[model samples]
Target: MKRLRLAAPLAAAVVALLPGTAQADVTYPDPQPITGQEIIHDPTVIRLKNGGYVSYSTGGVIGARTSKDRVHWDDAGNAFAEPPEWWYEYNDTGDPWAPDISYRDGRYWLYYAVSSWGTNHSAIGVATSRTGLPGTWTDQGKVFTSETTDTWNAIDPAVIRADGRLWMAFGSYWTGIRMVELNPRTGKAAEDATVHHLATRPDAPYAVEGPEIVKHGRYYYLFASYDACCSGVNSTYKIKVGRSTDIEGPYVDSTGKPLLEGGGDLVLEGHGRYIGTGGQSVFEDRGKDWLAYHYYDAEDDGTPKLGLNRLHWTKTGWPEVF
Candidate 1:
Protein backbone atom coordinates (compact mmCIF):
# COMPACT_ATOMS: atom_id res chain seq x y z
CA MET A 1 0.00 0.00 0.00
CA LYS A 2 1.09 3.62 -0.73
CA ARG A 3 -0.14 7.12 -1.27
CA LEU A 4 -2.87 7.95 -3.77
CA ARG A 5 -1.70 7.41 -7.34
CA LEU A 6 -1.35 11.07 -8.05
CA ALA A 7 1.59 13.49 -8.44
CA ALA A 8 5.17 12.34 -7.85
CA PRO A 9 8.65 13.45 -8.73
CA LEU A 10 9.45 13.07 -12.42
CA ALA A 11 12.57 11.23 -13.50
CA ALA A 12 14.28 11.26 -16.86
CA ALA A 13 12.81 8.86 -19.42
CA VAL A 14 10.34 7.04 -17.18
CA VAL A 15 9.03 5.05 -20.16
CA ALA A 16 12.49 3.74 -20.93
CA LEU A 17 12.69 2.48 -17.38
CA LEU A 18 9.58 0.37 -17.94
CA PRO A 19 9.95 -1.69 -21.11
CA GLY A 20 6.75 -3.14 -22.48
CA THR A 21 6.18 -6.83 -22.95
CA ALA A 22 3.55 -8.25 -25.25
CA GLN A 23 3.78 -11.67 -23.63
CA ALA A 24 4.79 -13.13 -20.28
CA ASP A 25 8.01 -15.03 -19.89
CA VAL A 26 9.47 -17.56 -17.48
CA THR A 27 12.53 -15.53 -16.56
CA TYR A 28 12.65 -12.48 -14.30
CA PRO A 29 14.49 -9.20 -14.86
CA ASP A 30 16.96 -7.10 -12.82
CA PRO A 31 16.22 -4.03 -10.72
CA GLN A 32 17.06 -0.45 -11.70
CA PRO A 33 20.21 1.24 -10.35
CA ILE A 34 19.89 2.78 -6.89
CA THR A 35 22.40 4.13 -4.35
CA GLY A 36 22.52 5.53 -0.82
CA GLN A 37 20.89 3.95 2.28
CA GLU A 38 20.91 0.39 0.95
CA ILE A 39 20.50 -1.63 4.14
CA ILE A 40 16.84 -2.50 4.43
CA HIS A 41 14.69 -5.56 4.94
CA ASP A 42 10.98 -5.97 4.23
CA PRO A 43 10.85 -2.33 3.17
CA THR A 44 7.62 -0.41 2.46
CA VAL A 45 7.60 3.09 0.99
CA ILE A 46 4.91 5.76 0.75
CA ARG A 47 4.95 9.21 -0.78
CA LEU A 48 4.24 11.95 1.73
CA LYS A 49 1.44 14.41 1.14
CA ASN A 50 4.07 17.05 0.53
CA GLY A 51 5.71 15.00 -2.29
CA GLY A 52 8.63 13.60 -0.28
CA TYR A 53 9.09 9.85 0.21
CA VAL A 54 9.26 7.93 3.52
CA SER A 55 10.16 4.26 4.01
CA TYR A 56 10.04 1.79 6.93
CA SER A 57 11.61 -1.62 7.46
CA THR A 58 12.34 -4.41 9.94
CA GLY A 59 14.65 -3.57 12.80
CA GLY A 60 14.96 -3.33 16.55
CA VAL A 61 12.93 -0.15 16.48
CA ILE A 62 11.50 -0.09 12.96
CA GLY A 63 14.10 1.71 10.81
CA ALA A 64 13.00 4.69 8.70
CA ARG A 65 14.40 7.00 6.03
CA THR A 66 13.34 9.96 3.93
CA SER A 67 14.00 10.84 0.32
CA LYS A 68 13.14 13.94 -1.62
CA ASP A 69 14.00 12.38 -5.01
CA ARG A 70 13.22 8.71 -4.15
CA VAL A 71 16.86 7.84 -4.88
CA HIS A 72 19.12 9.69 -2.45
CA TRP A 73 18.00 9.04 1.10
CA ASP A 74 18.73 10.23 4.63
CA ASP A 75 18.11 8.48 7.90
CA ALA A 76 14.94 9.77 9.55
CA GLY A 77 15.07 7.62 12.75
CA ASN A 78 12.83 4.88 14.13
CA ALA A 79 9.11 5.14 14.88
CA PHE A 80 9.48 4.33 18.57
CA ALA A 81 13.00 5.63 19.36
CA GLU A 82 12.65 2.94 22.02
CA PRO A 83 10.42 -0.10 22.04
CA PRO A 84 6.79 0.50 22.92
CA GLU A 85 5.66 -0.86 26.28
CA TRP A 86 3.27 -3.33 24.69
CA TRP A 87 5.91 -4.77 22.34
CA TYR A 88 7.53 -6.68 25.21
CA GLU A 89 4.34 -8.70 25.56
CA TYR A 90 4.76 -10.24 22.11
CA ASN A 91 8.52 -10.11 21.57
CA ASP A 92 10.92 -10.04 24.46
CA THR A 93 13.72 -8.83 22.15
CA GLY A 94 11.60 -5.85 21.10
CA ASP A 95 12.25 -6.27 17.37
CA PRO A 96 9.65 -5.73 14.64
CA TRP A 97 9.48 -7.04 11.08
CA ALA A 98 7.69 -6.51 7.79
CA PRO A 99 5.84 -3.24 8.38
CA ASP A 100 3.07 -2.14 5.98
CA ILE A 101 2.36 1.57 5.53
CA SER A 102 -0.59 3.30 3.95
CA TYR A 103 -2.48 6.59 4.07
CA ARG A 104 -6.15 6.52 5.01
CA ASP A 105 -8.90 8.54 6.70
CA GLY A 106 -6.70 11.49 7.60
CA ARG A 107 -3.85 9.42 9.09
CA TYR A 108 -1.04 7.05 8.20
CA TRP A 109 -1.60 3.48 9.38
CA LEU A 110 1.44 1.25 9.94
CA TYR A 111 0.99 -2.45 10.58
CA TYR A 112 3.98 -4.56 11.68
CA ALA A 113 4.86 -8.01 13.05
CA VAL A 114 6.36 -9.04 16.39
CA SER A 115 7.75 -12.51 17.04
CA SER A 116 10.85 -14.57 17.34
CA TRP A 117 12.08 -16.19 14.12
CA GLY A 118 10.78 -19.64 13.16
CA THR A 119 7.94 -19.75 15.68
CA ASN A 120 4.17 -19.40 15.67
CA HIS A 121 4.28 -17.18 18.79
CA SER A 122 3.63 -13.85 17.18
CA ALA A 123 1.42 -10.79 16.95
CA ILE A 124 0.52 -8.12 14.40
CA GLY A 125 0.26 -4.55 15.68
CA VAL A 126 -0.55 -1.11 14.29
CA ALA A 127 0.56 2.50 14.78
CA THR A 128 -1.05 5.65 13.42
CA SER A 129 0.25 9.14 12.63
CA ARG A 130 -0.90 12.33 10.98
CA THR A 131 2.45 13.17 9.33
CA GLY A 132 3.95 9.69 8.83
CA LEU A 133 7.25 10.99 10.15
CA PRO A 134 9.39 9.32 12.78
CA GLY A 135 8.39 9.44 16.49
CA THR A 136 4.86 10.58 15.67
CA TRP A 137 3.03 7.25 15.57
CA THR A 138 0.69 6.16 18.38
CA ASP A 139 0.65 2.44 19.06
CA GLN A 140 -2.80 0.93 18.52
CA GLY A 141 -1.98 -2.47 20.09
CA LYS A 142 -2.18 -5.92 18.51
CA VAL A 143 -4.45 -6.34 15.52
CA PHE A 144 -3.96 -10.13 15.45
CA THR A 145 -1.82 -12.94 16.93
CA SER A 146 -1.20 -16.66 17.02
CA GLU A 147 0.14 -19.36 19.34
CA THR A 148 1.61 -22.87 18.92
CA THR A 149 -1.92 -24.25 18.90
CA ASP A 150 -2.99 -22.16 15.91
CA THR A 151 -2.60 -23.35 12.32
CA TRP A 152 -1.25 -20.01 11.18
CA ASN A 153 1.31 -17.50 12.47
CA ALA A 154 0.42 -13.82 12.51
CA ILE A 155 3.25 -11.94 10.76
CA ASP A 156 4.02 -10.07 7.53
CA PRO A 157 0.92 -7.86 7.65
CA ALA A 158 -0.10 -6.32 4.30
CA VAL A 159 -3.25 -4.24 4.47
CA ILE A 160 -5.20 -2.96 1.49
CA ARG A 161 -8.49 -1.17 0.94
CA ALA A 162 -10.82 -3.11 -1.34
CA ASP A 163 -14.51 -3.77 -1.94
CA GLY A 164 -15.56 -0.96 0.41
CA ARG A 165 -13.61 -2.53 3.29
CA LEU A 166 -10.10 -2.66 4.79
CA TRP A 167 -8.48 -6.11 4.75
CA MET A 168 -5.20 -7.26 6.29
CA ALA A 169 -3.35 -10.21 4.69
CA PHE A 170 -0.71 -11.93 6.88
CA GLY A 171 0.90 -15.24 7.91
CA SER A 172 4.20 -17.09 7.67
CA TYR A 173 5.61 -20.69 7.59
CA TRP A 174 2.63 -22.36 9.25
CA THR A 175 -0.15 -22.57 6.64
CA GLY A 176 0.34 -19.62 4.22
CA ILE A 177 -1.33 -16.21 3.82
CA ARG A 178 -4.57 -15.41 5.65
CA MET A 179 -6.90 -12.42 5.54
CA VAL A 180 -9.40 -10.91 7.97
CA GLU A 181 -11.78 -8.00 7.71
CA LEU A 182 -10.70 -4.79 9.51
CA ASN A 183 -13.03 -2.13 10.78
CA PRO A 184 -12.55 1.03 8.74
CA ARG A 185 -13.14 3.17 11.81
CA THR A 186 -10.51 1.44 14.00
CA GLY A 187 -8.19 -0.55 11.71
CA LYS A 188 -8.78 -3.64 13.81
CA ALA A 189 -10.37 -6.95 12.97
CA ALA A 190 -14.16 -6.85 12.86
CA GLU A 191 -15.99 -8.74 15.59
CA ASP A 192 -17.44 -12.11 14.52
CA ALA A 193 -15.62 -12.33 11.16
CA THR A 194 -14.37 -15.32 9.28
CA VAL A 195 -10.66 -15.62 8.47
CA HIS A 196 -10.04 -16.31 4.77
CA HIS A 197 -7.15 -18.56 3.72
CA LEU A 198 -5.32 -17.23 0.68
CA ALA A 199 -2.18 -19.08 -0.52
CA THR A 200 0.18 -21.89 0.49
CA ARG A 201 2.94 -24.14 -0.88
CA PRO A 202 1.73 -27.30 0.92
CA ASP A 203 4.93 -29.18 0.15
CA ALA A 204 7.95 -29.88 2.35
CA PRO A 205 9.30 -26.63 3.80
CA TYR A 206 6.01 -25.04 2.67
CA ALA A 207 7.83 -21.77 1.91
CA VAL A 208 5.45 -18.94 1.22
CA GLU A 209 5.02 -15.52 2.90
CA GLY A 210 4.99 -11.74 2.33
CA PRO A 211 1.67 -11.47 0.49
CA GLU A 212 0.76 -8.21 -1.30
CA ILE A 213 -2.35 -7.60 -3.37
CA VAL A 214 -2.89 -5.01 -6.10
CA LYS A 215 -5.82 -4.52 -8.46
CA HIS A 216 -5.26 -3.97 -12.15
CA GLY A 217 -8.08 -3.82 -14.64
CA ARG A 218 -10.43 -6.77 -14.11
CA TYR A 219 -8.10 -8.77 -11.90
CA TYR A 220 -6.69 -8.55 -8.39
CA TYR A 221 -3.11 -9.87 -8.32
CA LEU A 222 -1.56 -11.63 -5.31
CA PHE A 223 2.23 -11.57 -5.05
CA ALA A 224 4.28 -13.66 -2.60
CA SER A 225 7.83 -14.73 -1.79
CA TYR A 226 8.91 -18.36 -1.95
CA ASP A 227 11.76 -20.48 -0.47
CA ALA A 228 14.32 -19.72 2.29
CA CYS A 229 15.68 -16.30 3.20
CA CYS A 230 18.30 -14.67 5.46
CA SER A 231 20.84 -17.31 4.47
CA GLY A 232 23.23 -14.80 2.96
CA VAL A 233 24.26 -15.84 -0.58
CA ASN A 234 22.65 -19.24 -0.03
CA SER A 235 19.18 -17.68 0.23
CA THR A 236 16.78 -18.86 -2.48
CA TYR A 237 14.14 -16.18 -2.11
CA LYS A 238 12.19 -15.21 -5.27
CA ILE A 239 8.90 -13.53 -6.06
CA LYS A 240 5.82 -15.13 -7.66
CA VAL A 241 2.32 -13.90 -8.45
CA GLY A 242 -1.27 -14.99 -9.23
CA ARG A 243 -4.53 -13.24 -10.02
CA SER A 244 -8.22 -13.46 -9.10
CA THR A 245 -11.49 -11.62 -9.65
CA ASP A 246 -12.24 -11.45 -5.92
CA ILE A 247 -9.93 -10.19 -3.17
CA GLU A 248 -10.56 -13.36 -1.13
CA GLY A 249 -9.29 -15.43 -3.97
CA PRO A 250 -8.94 -18.78 -5.42
CA TYR A 251 -6.06 -17.12 -7.25
CA VAL A 252 -4.52 -18.76 -10.28
CA ASP A 253 -1.41 -18.35 -12.36
CA SER A 254 -1.23 -17.94 -16.15
CA THR A 255 -1.61 -21.69 -16.66
CA GLY A 256 -4.76 -21.69 -14.46
CA LYS A 257 -3.01 -23.41 -11.57
CA PRO A 258 -4.51 -22.56 -8.18
CA LEU A 259 -2.32 -20.61 -5.76
CA LEU A 260 -3.78 -22.67 -2.93
CA GLU A 261 -1.95 -25.63 -4.48
CA GLY A 262 1.44 -23.91 -4.85
CA GLY A 263 0.77 -22.21 -8.18
CA GLY A 264 2.30 -18.86 -9.14
CA ASP A 265 3.94 -17.14 -12.12
CA LEU A 266 7.51 -15.97 -11.65
CA VAL A 267 7.85 -12.20 -11.27
CA LEU A 268 11.41 -11.69 -9.93
CA GLU A 269 14.51 -13.62 -8.87
CA GLY A 270 18.09 -12.94 -7.88
CA HIS A 271 20.41 -11.81 -10.67
CA GLY A 272 24.14 -10.94 -10.78
CA ARG A 273 25.18 -9.30 -7.51
CA TYR A 274 21.65 -9.28 -6.14
CA ILE A 275 20.60 -12.37 -4.22
CA GLY A 276 17.58 -13.44 -2.21
CA THR A 277 15.25 -10.78 -3.60
CA GLY A 278 11.77 -10.87 -2.10
CA GLY A 279 9.34 -9.06 0.27
CA GLN A 280 7.68 -6.69 -2.15
CA SER A 281 5.11 -3.91 -2.40
CA VAL A 282 3.56 -2.30 -5.49
CA PHE A 283 2.33 1.25 -6.04
CA GLU A 284 1.64 3.66 -8.88
CA ASP A 285 3.11 7.17 -9.11
CA ARG A 286 2.50 9.70 -11.84
CA GLY A 287 0.87 7.11 -14.12
CA LYS A 288 3.81 4.69 -13.80
CA ASP A 289 3.94 1.57 -11.66
CA TRP A 290 6.84 0.54 -9.41
CA LEU A 291 7.88 -2.57 -7.46
CA ALA A 292 9.82 -2.15 -4.20
CA TYR A 293 11.64 -4.90 -2.31
CA HIS A 294 14.93 -5.89 -0.69
CA TYR A 295 17.87 -7.89 -2.05
CA TYR A 296 21.02 -9.24 -0.44
CA ASP A 297 24.08 -7.75 -2.08
CA ALA A 298 26.34 -10.64 -2.94
CA GLU A 299 29.28 -8.29 -3.43
CA ASP A 300 28.72 -6.81 0.01
CA ASP A 301 28.62 -10.15 1.80
CA GLY A 302 24.85 -10.56 1.84
CA THR A 303 23.88 -7.20 3.22
CA PRO A 304 20.23 -6.47 2.45
CA LYS A 305 19.58 -3.32 0.44
CA LEU A 306 16.67 -1.51 -1.13
CA GLY A 307 15.72 -2.47 -4.71
CA LEU A 308 13.24 -0.64 -6.94
CA ASN A 309 12.09 -1.14 -10.51
CA ARG A 310 9.48 0.03 -12.93
CA LEU A 311 6.55 -2.36 -13.36
CA HIS A 312 4.72 -2.79 -16.66
CA TRP A 313 1.61 -4.64 -17.57
CA THR A 314 2.12 -6.97 -20.50
CA LYS A 315 -0.39 -7.16 -23.29
CA THR A 316 -1.26 -10.48 -21.72
CA GLY A 317 -2.12 -8.50 -18.51
CA TRP A 318 0.60 -10.07 -16.34
CA PRO A 319 3.12 -7.78 -14.63
CA GLU A 320 6.83 -7.73 -15.53
CA VAL A 321 9.51 -5.84 -13.61
CA PHE A 322 11.90 -3.86 -15.75
Candidate 2:
Protein backbone atom coordinates (compact mmCIF):
# COMPACT_ATOMS: atom_id res chain seq x y z
CA MET A 1 0.00 0.00 0.00
CA LYS A 2 1.23 3.54 -0.63
CA ARG A 3 0.67 4.41 3.04
CA LEU A 4 2.95 1.62 4.13
CA ARG A 5 5.93 3.43 2.62
CA LEU A 6 5.67 5.98 5.45
CA ALA A 7 5.49 3.42 8.25
CA ALA A 8 9.26 3.04 8.35
CA PRO A 9 9.74 6.71 9.18
CA LEU A 10 7.00 6.60 11.81
CA ALA A 11 8.75 3.58 13.39
CA ALA A 12 12.11 5.34 13.28
CA ALA A 13 10.68 8.31 15.14
CA VAL A 14 9.74 5.80 17.88
CA VAL A 15 6.55 7.50 18.94
CA ALA A 16 3.24 8.62 17.56
CA LEU A 17 1.96 12.19 18.06
CA LEU A 18 -0.93 13.65 16.16
CA PRO A 19 -2.05 17.23 15.79
CA GLY A 20 -5.11 18.17 17.93
CA THR A 21 -4.74 14.85 19.72
CA ALA A 22 -1.70 15.80 21.80
CA GLN A 23 -0.79 18.84 23.84
CA ALA A 24 2.94 18.48 23.30
CA ASP A 25 4.25 17.61 19.84
CA VAL A 26 7.92 16.69 19.30
CA THR A 27 7.74 14.80 16.01
CA TYR A 28 6.42 15.65 12.50
CA PRO A 29 6.74 15.18 8.67
CA ASP A 30 10.47 15.70 8.07
CA PRO A 31 11.33 12.03 7.65
CA GLN A 32 11.02 12.28 3.88
CA PRO A 33 14.48 13.74 4.60
CA ILE A 34 13.86 16.36 1.97
CA THR A 35 16.94 17.89 0.33
CA GLY A 36 17.92 20.68 -2.10
CA GLN A 37 16.44 24.18 -2.44
CA GLU A 38 14.41 23.77 0.73
CA ILE A 39 13.57 27.42 1.17
CA ILE A 40 10.00 27.95 -0.01
CA HIS A 41 6.76 29.63 1.06
CA ASP A 42 3.08 29.14 0.28
CA PRO A 43 3.57 25.96 -1.75
CA THR A 44 1.01 24.07 -3.87
CA VAL A 45 2.30 20.71 -5.08
CA ILE A 46 1.03 18.33 -7.76
CA ARG A 47 2.05 14.97 -9.20
CA LEU A 48 2.56 15.08 -12.94
CA LYS A 49 1.12 12.62 -15.44
CA ASN A 50 4.62 11.23 -15.92
CA GLY A 51 4.80 10.59 -12.16
CA GLY A 52 7.24 13.32 -11.06
CA TYR A 53 6.23 15.92 -8.46
CA VAL A 54 6.37 19.66 -9.09
CA SER A 55 5.55 22.51 -6.71
CA TYR A 56 4.82 26.15 -7.48
CA SER A 57 5.27 28.75 -4.76
CA THR A 58 5.49 32.41 -3.84
CA GLY A 59 8.51 34.37 -5.07
CA GLY A 60 10.37 35.11 -8.29
CA VAL A 61 7.70 34.93 -10.96
CA ILE A 62 6.02 32.00 -9.30
CA GLY A 63 9.11 30.03 -8.26
CA ALA A 64 9.22 26.29 -8.96
CA ARG A 65 10.79 23.12 -7.63
CA THR A 66 10.56 19.56 -8.87
CA SER A 67 11.27 16.12 -7.39
CA LYS A 68 11.17 12.74 -9.04
CA ASP A 69 10.42 10.85 -5.82
CA ARG A 70 8.89 13.63 -3.71
CA VAL A 71 12.08 13.69 -1.61
CA HIS A 72 15.13 14.99 -3.44
CA TRP A 73 14.02 18.35 -4.80
CA ASP A 74 15.76 20.45 -7.43
CA ASP A 75 15.30 24.12 -8.23
CA ALA A 76 13.44 23.95 -11.53
CA GLY A 77 13.46 27.70 -12.14
CA ASN A 78 10.52 30.13 -12.42
CA ALA A 79 7.26 29.27 -14.14
CA PHE A 80 7.48 32.34 -16.33
CA ALA A 81 10.60 33.64 -18.07
CA GLU A 82 9.19 37.09 -17.38
CA PRO A 83 6.16 38.33 -15.47
CA PRO A 84 3.15 39.10 -17.62
CA GLU A 85 2.70 42.83 -18.14
CA TRP A 86 -0.73 42.65 -16.42
CA TRP A 87 0.91 41.75 -13.11
CA TYR A 88 2.50 45.19 -12.65
CA GLU A 89 -0.96 46.67 -12.11
CA TYR A 90 -1.16 44.83 -8.80
CA ASN A 91 2.44 45.24 -7.70
CA ASP A 92 5.42 47.24 -8.93
CA THR A 93 7.59 44.13 -8.98
CA GLY A 94 5.17 42.07 -11.06
CA ASP A 95 5.67 39.39 -8.40
CA PRO A 96 3.12 36.62 -8.04
CA TRP A 97 2.57 34.54 -4.93
CA ALA A 98 1.00 31.33 -3.64
CA PRO A 99 0.18 29.43 -6.81
CA ASP A 100 -2.25 26.51 -7.02
CA ILE A 101 -1.64 23.97 -9.79
CA SER A 102 -4.09 21.38 -11.05
CA TYR A 103 -4.49 19.11 -14.05
CA ARG A 104 -7.81 19.49 -15.86
CA ASP A 105 -9.00 18.23 -19.20
CA GLY A 106 -5.83 17.39 -21.21
CA ARG A 107 -3.76 20.32 -19.88
CA TYR A 108 -2.58 21.87 -16.60
CA TRP A 109 -3.97 25.08 -15.15
CA LEU A 110 -2.09 27.36 -12.76
CA TYR A 111 -3.65 30.07 -10.60
CA TYR A 112 -1.66 32.66 -8.61
CA ALA A 113 -2.03 35.94 -6.74
CA VAL A 114 -0.52 39.36 -7.36
CA SER A 115 -0.84 41.92 -4.58
CA SER A 116 1.13 44.40 -2.54
CA TRP A 117 1.92 43.88 1.10
CA GLY A 118 -0.51 45.44 3.62
CA THR A 119 -3.30 45.93 1.11
CA ASN A 120 -6.42 44.12 0.00
CA HIS A 121 -6.16 45.32 -3.60
CA SER A 122 -5.25 41.95 -5.01
CA ALA A 123 -5.97 39.71 -7.99
CA ILE A 124 -5.70 36.02 -8.70
CA GLY A 125 -4.48 35.16 -12.21
CA VAL A 126 -4.52 31.99 -14.28
CA ALA A 127 -2.07 30.40 -16.70
CA THR A 128 -2.15 27.17 -18.67
CA SER A 129 0.54 24.66 -19.55
CA ARG A 130 0.74 21.66 -21.81
CA THR A 131 3.41 19.76 -19.91
CA GLY A 132 2.77 20.94 -16.31
CA LEU A 133 6.41 22.00 -16.15
CA PRO A 134 7.92 25.35 -15.32
CA GLY A 135 8.46 27.64 -18.34
CA THR A 136 5.85 25.81 -20.42
CA TRP A 137 2.99 27.93 -19.01
CA THR A 138 1.29 30.69 -20.99
CA ASP A 139 -0.39 33.46 -19.02
CA GLN A 140 -4.19 33.34 -19.29
CA GLY A 141 -5.04 36.42 -17.17
CA LYS A 142 -7.17 37.00 -14.05
CA VAL A 143 -9.56 34.53 -12.49
CA PHE A 144 -10.71 36.79 -9.61
CA THR A 145 -9.85 40.00 -7.85
CA SER A 146 -10.57 41.98 -4.65
CA GLU A 147 -10.67 45.72 -4.23
CA THR A 148 -9.73 47.86 -1.23
CA THR A 149 -13.36 48.66 -0.59
CA ASP A 150 -14.36 45.01 -0.55
CA THR A 151 -14.26 42.91 2.60
CA TRP A 152 -12.52 39.85 1.18
CA ASN A 153 -9.02 39.76 -0.29
CA ALA A 154 -8.36 37.44 -3.21
CA ILE A 155 -5.16 35.43 -2.88
CA ASP A 156 -3.91 31.96 -2.05
CA PRO A 157 -6.19 29.97 -4.35
CA ALA A 158 -6.98 26.26 -4.01
CA VAL A 159 -9.38 24.58 -6.43
CA ILE A 160 -11.54 21.54 -6.04
CA ARG A 161 -14.13 19.93 -8.31
CA ALA A 162 -17.29 18.62 -6.72
CA ASP A 163 -20.53 17.31 -8.21
CA GLY A 164 -19.39 18.13 -11.73
CA ARG A 165 -18.75 21.80 -10.90
CA LEU A 166 -15.46 23.64 -10.32
CA TRP A 167 -14.91 25.92 -7.32
CA MET A 168 -12.07 28.07 -6.00
CA ALA A 169 -11.39 28.77 -2.33
CA PHE A 170 -9.36 31.91 -1.52
CA GLY A 171 -8.90 34.93 0.78
CA SER A 172 -6.53 36.37 3.34
CA TYR A 173 -6.58 38.39 6.63
CA TRP A 174 -9.28 40.82 5.52
CA THR A 175 -12.20 38.52 6.26
CA GLY A 176 -10.57 35.12 6.22
CA ILE A 177 -11.54 32.45 3.61
CA ARG A 178 -14.15 32.79 0.82
CA MET A 179 -15.20 30.75 -2.22
CA VAL A 180 -16.51 31.24 -5.75
CA GLU A 181 -17.69 28.96 -8.51
CA LEU A 182 -15.52 28.71 -11.62
CA ASN A 183 -16.51 28.18 -15.22
CA PRO A 184 -14.83 24.86 -15.98
CA ARG A 185 -14.63 25.75 -19.64
CA THR A 186 -12.46 28.86 -19.13
CA GLY A 187 -11.12 28.45 -15.59
CA LYS A 188 -12.65 31.79 -14.63
CA ALA A 189 -15.32 32.70 -12.14
CA ALA A 190 -18.70 31.60 -13.43
CA GLU A 191 -20.96 34.30 -14.80
CA ASP A 192 -22.60 36.10 -11.87
CA ALA A 193 -20.84 33.75 -9.49
CA THR A 194 -21.79 34.46 -5.92
CA VAL A 195 -18.98 34.77 -3.39
CA HIS A 196 -19.36 32.60 -0.33
CA HIS A 197 -17.62 32.90 3.02
CA LEU A 198 -16.10 29.74 4.48
CA ALA A 199 -13.92 30.46 7.54
CA THR A 200 -12.63 33.37 9.56
CA ARG A 201 -10.89 34.18 12.85
CA PRO A 202 -13.78 36.27 14.16
CA ASP A 203 -11.69 39.35 14.90
CA ALA A 204 -10.10 42.31 13.19
CA PRO A 205 -7.38 41.21 10.75
CA TYR A 206 -9.07 37.77 10.89
CA ALA A 207 -5.69 36.00 10.41
CA VAL A 208 -6.79 32.95 8.47
CA GLU A 209 -6.11 32.07 4.83
CA GLY A 210 -4.50 29.48 2.55
CA PRO A 211 -7.46 27.12 2.12
CA GLU A 212 -7.48 23.74 0.39
CA ILE A 213 -10.40 21.34 0.18
CA VAL A 214 -10.23 17.57 -0.04
CA LYS A 215 -13.21 15.27 -0.33
CA HIS A 216 -13.23 12.13 1.76
CA GLY A 217 -16.11 9.75 2.22
CA ARG A 218 -19.22 11.78 3.13
CA TYR A 219 -17.65 15.22 3.54
CA TYR A 220 -15.50 17.97 2.07
CA TYR A 221 -12.73 19.09 4.44
CA LEU A 222 -11.29 22.57 4.64
CA PHE A 223 -7.62 22.84 5.64
CA ALA A 224 -6.14 26.25 6.32
CA SER A 225 -3.24 28.20 7.79
CA TYR A 226 -3.93 30.42 10.78
CA ASP A 227 -2.05 33.25 12.51
CA ALA A 228 0.95 35.27 11.34
CA CYS A 229 3.50 33.96 8.83
CA CYS A 230 6.75 35.16 7.19
CA SER A 231 8.34 36.16 10.52
CA GLY A 232 10.70 33.18 10.64
CA VAL A 233 10.99 31.74 14.18
CA ASN A 234 8.77 34.48 15.50
CA SER A 235 5.99 33.36 13.21
CA THR A 236 2.96 32.06 15.08
CA TYR A 237 1.61 30.14 12.10
CA LYS A 238 -0.26 26.87 12.53
CA ILE A 239 -2.47 24.64 10.41
CA LYS A 240 -6.11 23.95 11.25
CA VAL A 241 -9.14 22.26 9.75
CA GLY A 242 -12.92 21.94 9.62
CA ARG A 243 -15.27 19.83 7.52
CA SER A 244 -18.68 20.07 5.88
CA THR A 245 -20.93 17.77 3.92
CA ASP A 246 -21.72 20.33 1.25
CA ILE A 247 -19.24 21.86 -1.18
CA GLU A 248 -20.53 25.31 -0.28
CA GLY A 249 -20.09 25.06 3.44
CA PRO A 250 -20.85 26.18 6.90
CA TYR A 251 -17.86 24.12 8.01
CA VAL A 252 -17.41 23.06 11.57
CA ASP A 253 -14.63 21.57 13.65
CA SER A 254 -14.97 18.36 15.64
CA THR A 255 -16.53 20.30 18.48
CA GLY A 256 -19.34 21.31 16.12
CA LYS A 257 -18.35 24.96 16.29
CA PRO A 258 -18.51 26.67 12.90
CA LEU A 259 -15.27 27.76 11.19
CA LEU A 260 -16.90 31.09 10.38
CA GLU A 261 -16.91 31.60 14.12
CA GLY A 262 -13.14 31.01 14.54
CA GLY A 263 -13.23 27.31 15.20
CA GLY A 264 -10.91 24.68 13.73
CA ASP A 265 -9.26 21.60 15.08
CA LEU A 266 -5.49 21.80 15.16
CA VAL A 267 -3.66 19.88 12.47
CA LEU A 268 -0.02 21.08 12.77
CA GLU A 269 1.86 23.61 14.86
CA GLY A 270 5.45 24.50 15.72
CA HIS A 271 7.00 21.58 17.53
CA GLY A 272 10.67 21.10 18.43
CA ARG A 273 12.89 22.42 15.64
CA TYR A 274 10.00 22.74 13.24
CA ILE A 275 8.51 26.15 13.84
CA GLY A 276 5.68 28.07 12.16
CA THR A 277 4.05 25.34 10.09
CA GLY A 278 1.76 27.14 7.63
CA GLY A 279 1.20 28.02 3.96
CA GLN A 280 -0.27 24.62 3.27
CA SER A 281 -1.89 22.52 0.54
CA VAL A 282 -2.68 18.82 0.26
CA PHE A 283 -2.25 16.36 -2.62
CA GLU A 284 -2.92 12.67 -3.15
CA ASP A 285 -0.18 10.33 -4.32
CA ARG A 286 -0.19 6.58 -4.76
CA GLY A 287 -3.63 6.24 -3.18
CA LYS A 288 -2.56 8.15 -0.07
CA ASP A 289 -2.94 11.72 1.05
CA TRP A 290 0.01 14.02 1.87
CA LEU A 291 -0.10 17.38 3.59
CA ALA A 292 2.40 19.90 2.21
CA TYR A 293 3.46 23.17 3.84
CA HIS A 294 6.54 25.26 4.71
CA TYR A 295 8.09 25.39 8.15
CA TYR A 296 10.79 27.44 9.79
CA ASP A 297 13.68 25.20 10.80
CA ALA A 298 15.09 26.41 14.10
CA GLU A 299 18.34 24.52 13.53
CA ASP A 300 18.75 26.07 10.09
CA ASP A 301 18.50 29.63 11.34
CA GLY A 302 14.79 29.71 10.64
CA THR A 303 15.10 29.01 6.94
CA PRO A 304 11.79 27.84 5.51
CA LYS A 305 11.83 24.18 4.48
CA LEU A 306 9.16 22.13 2.82
CA GLY A 307 6.92 20.26 5.26
CA LEU A 308 5.54 16.95 3.99
CA ASN A 309 3.57 14.49 6.08
CA ARG A 310 1.46 11.45 5.46
CA LEU A 311 -2.09 12.40 6.39
CA HIS A 312 -4.19 10.13 8.54
CA TRP A 313 -7.75 10.21 9.77
CA THR A 314 -9.16 9.32 13.15
CA LYS A 315 -12.06 6.92 13.58
CA THR A 316 -14.25 9.96 14.16
CA GLY A 317 -13.18 11.55 10.86
CA TRP A 318 -10.83 14.22 12.17
CA PRO A 319 -7.44 14.77 10.52
CA GLU A 320 -4.27 13.57 12.20
CA VAL A 321 -0.93 14.63 10.67
CA PHE A 322 1.89 12.11 11.09
Tell me the whole-model lDDT of each prediction, alpha carbons only. Answer: 0.82, 0.87
Candidate 1 lDDT over 185-275, as tens digits, reads: 8898865667899889868557899988888888888888888888888888888899999999988898888888988987777767889
List pairs with backbone clashes in candidate 2.
Answer: none
RMSD of 2: 3.9
Indicate the residue-level lDDT of 82 in model 2. Answer: 99
- Find the 10 residues in a row with the least total lDDT in model 1: 1-10
Off by over 4 Å in 1: 1-28
Candidate 2 deviant stretches above 4 angstroms: 1-31
Angstrom error of the Cα, residue 314, model 1: value is 1.2
